[model samples]
Target: MPRMLLVTVLALLCSACSSGGDRYDPPGLREVTAANQCMEQCQRHFDSCMTSSSSVDSSDRCGAGVATQRDTRCDTIDNPDLRKRCQASADYCRNRLPALTCGENRSRCVSRCGG
Candidate 1:
């Protein structure tokens, strides 16, 4: 009931973002391509964390999974700076996941790319 409504609402919000441009492509970025790339990475990490949890777990439980994934996943990036950026993005995304749509999340992640 409530879960289905939430899913439908999310779908509508996501569709709105896609209507303008690629969902990950934040506008007016000096490096659109770079921002897009960074956003994609952040989105993947966020989505994976979200899907890993059950409805019973909801956002807080999923947030813990994001933290766990951040440690393991961000450590894999060879570049120390990029690794730090990834972890930071994960932290920001996890903190706000319950309140933001995926497009909003991706937009916020532009900072990780220095955009």
Candidate 2:
């Protein structure tokens, strides 16, 4: 009887341990993710544009021009609210890109995007 009771208790404990909670994402997460992706694309485009527009010595001027173009393009997003959020995220990325390493930049942008 003691052995049977022990087995039952163990089974109960195992079942309890295996109970997986709901796996739902928080609200606005999808939107934020989309905006982050868009911002990354914009940044890549800006980098490419800068590379083609000027030599290494003129990088500062090129970067400024590219940033302005990126902001203009990002700001025209169809959804006003999303455009604002995306532009904010893009601005964050632009401001921090020169100061942070690649991994840190990604982490900071993700956090800034509300992820």
Candidate 3:
């Protein structure tokens, strides 16, 4: 769907940027892959985290778990800004948690970012 397309587009853009090694390290390709994987993981887990009708109810959901996975998921992305970057995706999942059923987390995230 549109969410996948947005992810694909963002991935393509990242790939293009990573290919231009003039700015990144020679091993930056692996880093890009890892970062992408981590983001995907975060998104997935975020969806999982909001399984309840009220995800904001911290007792059932744990932000730390998602934050941990994202922060340590990628070794290449050593910017130490995973929290900041993940916020958009996390916010997307958070806002959508009110749904009675599981919904499109990616679309939520993408839309949250104005995609």
Candidate 4:
């Protein structure tokens, strides 16, 4: 099981590295679809993280916010309490994103406790 898990993990990493796309773009006309995709990806990643923390799963949980943070109009926080504040900011971004547009996305983000 562990060996299969390792192969799956490696394959995921390689695919992620190769499947490059314009991640910064808004949802275009299909905001809901785009948000759903984002939300699905986030959920899958978070679920994998819950099952496995021996690798980049920790980063996956938080990295799920990358899309949200990019979309939100937040200024970079100063270094007063850098780590916590930045994480909080990311959390907020994730919450505000996929709210009304994508119901599934919104629910998943909420359950993820990103807000």
TM-score: the better of candidates 3 and 4: 3
TM-score of each: 0.30, 0.30, 0.26, 0.24
Top candidate (lDDT) = 1
Which of 1 and 4 is the better model by TM-score? Answer: 1
**Candidate 2, overall lDDT?**
0.63
Residue pair clashes in candidate 1 = none
Q: What's the TM for model 3?
A: 0.26
lDDT of each: 0.68, 0.63, 0.56, 0.56
- lDDT of model 1 at position 89: 79
Cα lDDT tens digits, model 3, 1-115, are: 9999999999999998778465544747876677677667656755664554453553234354563454355444656586456655555544444443344555565444433
What is the C-alpha lDDT profile of model 2 across 1-115, one tens digit per residue?
9999999999999998888967787669788678878678656755664554344333243365565666788767899888788777666655554323344544665566556
RMSD of each: 22.9, 14.2, 22.5, 23.4
lDDT of 1 by residue, 21-108 (tens): 6456445655777777887798786676456532434435445466677768999999999999998877675555443554566567
Backbone clashes (count) for model 3: 0
Candidate 4 lDDT, 1-115, residue by residue in tens: 9999999999999999899766686446676666666767776765654445434333344465473554343345455476456667666644443223244544667555433
